[model samples]
Target chain A: MEMFVHDETPTAAVDQREQVVSALAGSVRDLVDATIRSTVADEELLAVRAGVDALVARLRTEQRPGPAGVRYNSEGRSWSWGNAVVGHGNAIAPPLAIDHDTERGRSRAEVVLGAAYEGPPGMVHGGVSALLLDQIMGETASGFKRLTMTGTLTLRYRRPLPLGPVALECWIASEAGRKVTVEASIGNADGVAVEATGLFLVPRWAPLAADEQPEGWRRSAEG
Target chain B: MEMFVHDETPTAAVDQREQVVSALAGSVRDLVDATIRSTVADEELLAVRAGVDALVARLRTEQRPGPAGVRYNSEGRSWSWGNAVVGHGNAIAPPLAIDHDTERGRSRAEVVLGAAYEGPPGMVHGGVSALLLDQIMGETASGFKRLTMTGTLTLRYRRPLPLGPVALECWIASEAGRKVTVEASIGNADGVAVEATGLFLVPRWAPLAADEQPEGWRRSAEG
Candidate 1:
């Protein structure tokens, strides 16, 4: 009956299954990227299409009828792989992994932008940068305890971020009432290419965490 | 010597190929959604992976080593299928298509959100809504006559948008020198779910279009 104690499954077992599923999903994403850039002839393309469809049906021999909504167990392990940014099943997401330091309210991410994220020429899609920034910044603000929505975001693309590895770093700028401000930037070894500032706020609808709660917002360190 | 004459192919031919590629790519997108929700066992998943990879390889038998950049022809027809939002090859992109009306200085889009775009529970991802708005707003500002980049974007997530059909509309709010302000929103039959305002600017490195230019901004009706 306690908050966040819906299931008693050990975090280890949950994570192990998650790892297996994510790895498989990553490969599927790779296939998607390759399919988009291919210039093969129509006859071959149609054959491939039929094959892919059959394979998909095979994979879906058993399936979840609904989306994979967020879930957390008593062990404090939470997984939301359906997320657009970090869902292991998501090939559309950049190869991004962020290291969060709750002590300092800072987060850092390193990712490689490939052909899929390209917007103009070889540069990253401007919105991709925004998507990445909005996510990392929101994570830094929420720290997994409270759900925060991006209120407003301002981005300045000073220079093109090429289709390759990029670095992202951010920190909480300020907090007033329920509003948390975050500043972030993405770049390569050359330097920062895109800079961002965002305002994030906890919605009124969410029940505020009480002070008596034990470890209210701790994201599982393993993930 | 005329402007935007980089290719001599008939616009109709180019568009036909684009249509074909997009249709094939869309099927792959469906497969992607299926893969994420599949509950099949490891043996079946592995077999599916191999089959999908082989299909991808067949499609990529011919390829372009570089990103697909925007191309315009003498007839004022342009295509930028690699664009992050409108890219036909980009399965990660929201199925978004914007119809820009240069005469009215407005842009409209109709889309259907699916499993891939969820952020909170069954609602559309906030970032996805922001991404859609950014692209449509940019197009409204440029009118397909010049290059523009998002300088800053402000979004307010009014309410959760469920996974389903939605509508987007935008118009140029104002233009001052190289800066253009655009207002936009996304909604469904229920009502508007997200609202946005963005500032778009011509990069300093880009040469400004001459004042005497004839038919300064022309968007092809076909997208």
Candidate 2:
């Protein structure tokens, strides 16, 4: 079995399903934020939990055996609805909209993190910043054409990132054989908060030149 | 205005609230997992979304203005219900129950990664591993006493961790003045998967002898 799934589902059908999934995730994200900050009475809270459980059972009546792995159709549309960083259907994922400039070998995203992403009193969690950087760097290194795994990630917390709108940008800094070096950062209006440098390795099993497409891999607009 | 909130709520009251919050979060986590792997028809999925939204509205009836910052009561009971890594009320936080061995200067935890925590196929997300390490190392350095912030965190992905039970352990490797160096790792039944080293720093403004407690800070069982 190939790692990259060649999903034969039609592009139109995939898009429709993505819309439904994204909508559900958005509401769940709101539910999470509300749960953290709620001051409702215990009885009401219990009532809400029961409601949530009922909903879960309804969704589970028909389900996949495992996770929603990255899949691409013949029309070059791909989606990894379960991705931790950018899954459209992942409620816990920060609301990040990344712009991939493959030609420029760079990627950028802007997101407004709310209460759910906090670590320190009013600052973004350090690991959340790392999560964003890793995703963007991985995408930048892979360029949505090849498979690259994060080899090593180093982060320096130069400043505390306040919980609010933040910007992230990453670019391919260098490449040596199968290893790609990527530099990234998460910042706000003041300046950069966290700086990251990552080494991404193209596994030997999926080695392919930049211009050549691997047998089972298909390029997609989303991943 | 203190960074660590001195919540006047009694310890018993806090515990009662925590139980309620935890139950709600537990259900939400299940909802997240079910949504990820659900292959339900579009109509059923849409119906589930409606149900989820109703629950969100009910929970939001009375909500705090912002995130749940770290809080401690007079009884030395602390709770950070919104902490991204270990918040009892946070559905997105991995189910990490850390055992703080202050005497031996070590901390450990074990959790099972479900479908919600995946990244590269069947493997755990690299960022999730970093997240767990950062939280455990932070607690290890602080020892639930003085406050310490992450200054630098470096991680090496030695192997990919599958979606299942994993162990995490961290210890205070060294300490110099206000800086503490901690080493930690996440491993499966097979062996270590990710290795981490972190520098946790005590801000000069809140410095205190390890044996002395800060004026506004109270040691808590959880943070």
Best by TM-score: 2
TM-score for each candidate, following the candidate numbering: 0.88, 0.95
Clashing pairs in 1: A145-A217
Per-residue CA lDDT of candidate 1, range B98-214, in tens?
787977889999988776775565667677777788778877887766567777778776776877899999998998888888899998999998888888887675544635233
With candidate 1 superimposed using the best TM-score fit, by how many Å does residue A174's alpha carbon deviate from the native? 1.4
Q: Is the docking of candidate 1 incorrect, acceptable, medium or high quality?
A: acceptable
lDDT of 2 at A11: 95
Candidate 1 lDDT by residue in tens digits, A30-138: 7667766777776776677777678777877788776655557776676666667766665565546789997798999998877677666667777778778877887
lDDT of 2 at A187: 98
Residue-level lDDT for B117 in candidate 1: 71
| Candidate 2 DockQ vs. native | 0.60
True contact recovery of candidate 2: 0.67
